[model samples]
Target: MAGTGTRLTLLLFSALGFWTLWGFPGKNNLLHFLGELSEPGASIPGPTYYPMKQKFTGIAPLDKQLTTLVGFFYTAVDGNRIDISLSFLNLGSQVLAAWILITTESYRAGNKGSFIITSTTLFGLSVVIVGYACVAPIWFALHLWTSKVVSNPRDWNIILEQPIKLAIAPVATLIGFGIPSAVMTLPAPSVISFDTKLNWSALQQGWPIWIYLAQKSLESIATWFQPMVSMRTEKQKRAEMVKYMRRAYLFALGTSAGAHLLYSGLGLAAYFLPGALSTKLQVQLQPENFFIPPNPFSDEKATTLPNGALWFLQWDLVIGVLATMIWGIAVRLSENGKQDDLGAWIKALVEYGVIAAAVGPSGAAVVAVWRRDERALKAKEE
Candidate 1:
């Protein structure tokens, strides 16, 4: 059954990732867009091609793509009101998902089994280049097969959430991911010059690089800052570690839930008080726009650069959410993984549907992880 689930997830994500990379964007669109930017001094085709709005700077294809990414990212914040909300939502969820899925907690004594991939750093460079839709599933599938991280007690026993990591996760998520995003969204000239915003947006594209650097740097800086303290015993240290893990979980819950409410409330406000809000703001805040995804089955291309930008990005968000939900439900840690499996899933699906609708996907994910952790802790205690 585990092998079957693993194979199915692999096939599903591979197909979806291919479609998302090529199907939605179309071959001509990709060629034409890249062709236009292939040269440093290319002519602007039109507004439709305006990543063409920000002229391509680099001569090489990879360099050109990286340069174009700066403007492409900026458009979500500065382009359409609707895309801003969706883009920000995805951005927030992406960071949270990285933390949840990867848990790149720093290496320390007593934390031997921790998953740390330094090549991408903690932030996921592949996620940067290939989109989260593609990278997350591959990562999740690797996790499903390589780590005995199911909901069973014996399986989870080896994967203890380290105390140092639990405390650091929140700090990493906030500073490493959160600060970069906030800077990218700041208003132009008044807050920062237009050029500065673009440059900052350029820097934002390399999140996988910077977040990991920041995390590791923080590890060193934190060592000095952490008050001179020591655990009394092995048992006391383990209990403290559990406490830190729970706090990390709470931090995730609060951040995700707060965002869900803030946006949902604004969306509702836009619905009721349409006259008070600008047309674009209204479009941005509409909850309906938040979850709509490109037709993954279709090869039709987006009409405009901004639409293409949205299309370029949205699948990762949508597919990432789907994959997480599957991981949460399928990787069972219930009291009876074999005996109560079916009932556990049915009940969890219902509960997740309710919570997800109310609080948003990230919020529901936090709840699921928290519950899973609690169950594992209880079983370990017993």
Candidate 2:
């Protein structure tokens, strides 16, 4: 049997290989494909035409052409719309591969299924909580900046006739704050909250429901209050606001990277380590294979589950709802506190809500379907 050292070495190498093939270059390839799909009318010159093109464009056109070509290759492989399928597959592979690597690492670290379960459960929760937390400061900063930029009397003259816009500013700012607040208050079955008797059923109960409504109402009020609050002192507000913007940017980037690394590490360890260790042991280990549903963008339904009820619930609805909430919070918080004007604030809130509504549900839907399939596959093996 291979020693633990050998197994560790293999795991490292495997992870490195996966990252190399599917991480950096893969991202570039995906970008190239997107660019091509986005701008299909762009001409693609031959390799020999590089020197002539370089003189005119100040860069080799070959590089751009190559990216588009590679993107086209992946699109052909999927046999779907070049833009959509290529983007989906690239993202799916990156996330899935990251999870596999994380899962393997977690198992090696003696965390068991803690990595997978926590990562999956908190995936939605983190987006809502962390995402919004970061956004609050950013919005505050933006509002301050805009206020400073537009403070001049000359600028105000441009909107002298637009009294309604001025009146709407503060109200809009408060609503922007409300988005994250709503998300934070929403009931989610998290690893931490799971044992607290605050499950979905409890949340749906009278007290919880009332609390939810009250919180939403409070958030709406706060949204309106945010702009008015800033009007208290322009100088103090600008300084404080700038501080928040800086802090928020740092917080969002740092926390996001940290969270991604943590989850990815856990997922990779869970999915890959067992098989690797078994291979070293020469025991022909049939490591559990998690089901990953096919891309919804594909022609097929991509539903992997056969037990209709479980499949529908697991793959179709719950996780997606969670993801939507999380993403909604993220976008809302990210854009919050950026305006002293009610109209601008309202516009920001509406924009974030729309984005979150569309993206959150769709993203969550995909994740739920994937996780459900994984659970079902594991069950079958057992």
Best by lDDT: 1
For candidate 2, the TM-score is 0.24
- lDDT: worst 10-residue window of model 2: 46-55
The Cα local distance difference test for each model comes to 0.58, 0.29
The best candidate by TM-score is 1
Q: What shift in Å separates residue 339 of candidate 1 from its native position after superposition?
A: 9.7
| lDDT digits (tens) for residues 1-382 of candidate 1 | 2345544775597578767765666642643464444456643223323323243345555567665566556557664445554556654664474454356222223224545322336437666776667766665565555444442334234344335555666677677667777787786656876666666676677666666676667766666776432433556656766687678767766666666566566767777888887877877666565446556566666555555666666666667666765555554433346413656666877888788766666567667666655666677678
Cα lDDT tens digits, model 2, 43-98, are: 22212111111122234564444333332322222222222222222232222222
